[model samples]
Target: WKSLIRVVVSGAAGMISNHLLFKLASGEVFGPDQPIALRLLGSERSYQALEGVAMELEDSLYPLLREVSIGVNPYDVFEDAEWALLVGAKPRGPGMERAALLDINGQIFAEQGKALNAVASRSVKVMVVGNPCNTNALICLKNAPNIPAKNFHALTRLDENRAKCQLALKAGVFYDKVSNVTIWGNHSTTQVPDFVNAKINGVPVKKVITDTKWLEQEFTERVQKRGGVLIQKWGRSSAASTAVSIVDGIRSLITPTPEGDWFSSGVYTNGNPYGIAEDIVFSMPCRSKGDGDYELVKDVVIDDFLRERLKKTEAELIAEKRCVAHLTGE
Candidate 1:
């Protein structure tokens, strides 16, 4: 048996976790050579559902899955974990204000941050997948003063992957042929998917598609709104695709992509060239080597239009940060 790696997945009983757990158990996220001990954390109210899911996972009898444990408390689940996925949050239901949603998630993440600080292993890496994930990640980072800031990342790879799929479809190229796609700013509607420097088969994407007007109109909007489109088509929110992106994000983190090729992720900005304020969590093209540090991609051309969009998205993130600060009195 391979050595066991403890993986803590918060919000273990939620819809997204339901979709993600099977892949993790089957050794799709972590390599097959590694044994996994899944540590699940959920709210007390969802403990029964988590147990049921654990029972199902047990029946699968995955060779690499050495153990599965469930807990209602974050500290218990985080104990000695090597990786922690902060997937649980206060999801918005019908007729909820943005502020209300952020407030609820901030409280949840604050508590989780303390728990992570207390019990997660010294080298634990965390990825926050909850909605408003960037700021929620910020809350966790601020509270977990013990952990390195770079070790706590938020999920923006989902948006980046969506952009790649859509771009590939439009360019009549295979998805693997596309590279250098970037998702900047927040993870919401305002998130900027930079295709300016992207390529198909190593040729600049602009050379393939000359319709600047159409590029400005359709491509950008489609990538930004793909989640809503998926919801419209499926009559529910995206789970499978989101789960796949999470896997990809983690994989990229563990196995660094080659130089000159990078993926988008929510990373800490010390007010870098992108004009993002100091320490704010925002998505940028980043390269990692599985050591938990993400270096930002710099000097890519940002046209006037792209700059405006980036500003707009950054504004949204700033507003979110302030709103959460107000609620939590931070």
Candidate 2:
């Protein structure tokens, strides 16, 4: 068995983490043979709830869970952390402006970044799950100058999974039949779910579905706005499915990609071949070799339609970065 892997989770008392913590304790993410120590980070308002969460973990009696720690300070909980899941952020209230929300969450990530830089493992893998995540991730990596920019990621796996499900349902196939459904650019409604490159049962999606109009219009809109649609139906943002996507996101990094398959993730865009702006976290197709290292999937054919969509989403991300520029030290 491998040694204990230390994980730090921010927003540990929230809905997403509420579902995610138990999965981590059960060794679903890092494998059952690998023991894990979880450090849960929360704010003062959520400390008591965090303790309740710890009590639940104890009751679960997971064999691979070696230790659990809860605290309000990131510095105290993040020490030597190997995996940091940043799932906490200020949600936009009824009257809150988008820029105001960005500034508030940007401050939170900036502090957490400094704390992680000071105490966490030099090679710690950071996944930003907070809202405006791509920009928040950029702010985080900028603050933690010592950590490699490639080590930071923003969650876009949920969007990828959503796109796949849409394709599968339209084609009357299992979800697993869809491949290469990359989410380009931001995680917001501006996100472009690239069905052009997607394949169904090893065939191009357009050829199988025979509804290029739907794929170009309704299909893209569905994936981009699925979160809001869910909230309208459920009265809350996604939690369980979001947790599953997080597992998939981490697993994709640790496991080798199939010979011709790639997964989508929001990663640093420096030197990317897609003409994306550098120094920003953007979602793109990537492949890994099971060594916790990944490279962008080059050679994706972007036609005029996909290129225009990419430019739109990229503009949104660039605008978001500008909104948090002061926090990012730009």
Candidate 3:
């Protein structure tokens, strides 16, 4: 094994983490030679399911899996953790309001924030994957002042992947051939899938495909509501793809960005490319150095269309921050 580090995964019994755990154990996020010590966190009601997951993990007998621990206590689960995948939060059900959902999860993430601040490794990196993740990341980041803001992130890489796939399909190219796709602002429907800067096999996307109608309307809406579209077609929300996106997000953090290409991630607006309000966890085109650190890619072309869309997502995040204003004490 290349290295051994403790990783705490929240919502260990949930669907996303159920797939994520295996990926982590198999060294998909890290490297094949790396061993990981996994600490699974769940709600009290999910303890039995967590145990069954642990049992299956043991049955799989992954060589890179050094050790496994399960608990419902955040304090216990977060202790000595180097990486925390905060995936557990109240999923939005039928007729549920965003404000109500945030309030419920506010308490959960607030407690976790405290536990992470109190006991986790000083360099611990936290990735928020639960719903309302951008704001939820803000809550956790606000609650942990000791850790650097850059240490916390929300998963917008899913949107980035979705945008790349959509563009690739429209361009009649493979997804791997798509690069420089950015998911700007919130991970919600207001997100901007920037095809303006996207490239398919080193050719400018716009130069290759000249359907302005498709790019302006269909591309925008499809990337924004792809999650809902999937649910309508499959009778479920995204799970496997979400899991893959999580792996891509983490890998982007731990691996250096490819030359001339960047990935998108939800990050604090401190010294960002945009002039958006500070303290909003916004997604920006980013380059990583494989050191658990990232730098925003700046000075990209932003026409009126892109600018307007960015503002809308910014406004949505601002309103979301206001809804949880009580939690942030701002």
Question: Sort by TM-score, best first: what order?
Answer: 2, 3, 1
Candidate 3, position 197, lDDT: 87
lDDT of 2 by residue, 121-199 (tens): 9999999999989999999999999999999999999999999999999999999989988999999999999988999
- Candidate with the greatest lDDT versus the true structure: 2
List candidate 3 segments past 4 Å from native: none
TM-score of each: 0.96, 0.99, 0.98
Better of 2 and 3 by lDDT: 2
Number of clashing pairs, model 2? 0
RMSD of each candidate relative to the true structure: 1.5, 0.7, 1.0
User: Per-residue error at 140 for model 3, in Å?
Assistant: 0.4
| Candidate 3 accuracy as lDDT | 0.90
Clashes of each: 0, 0, 1
Q: Rate the local accuracy (lDDT) of all candidates.
A: 0.86, 0.93, 0.90
lDDT of 3 by residue, 65-153 (tens): 99999999999999989999999988887899989998999878888988999999989999999979999999998988888889999
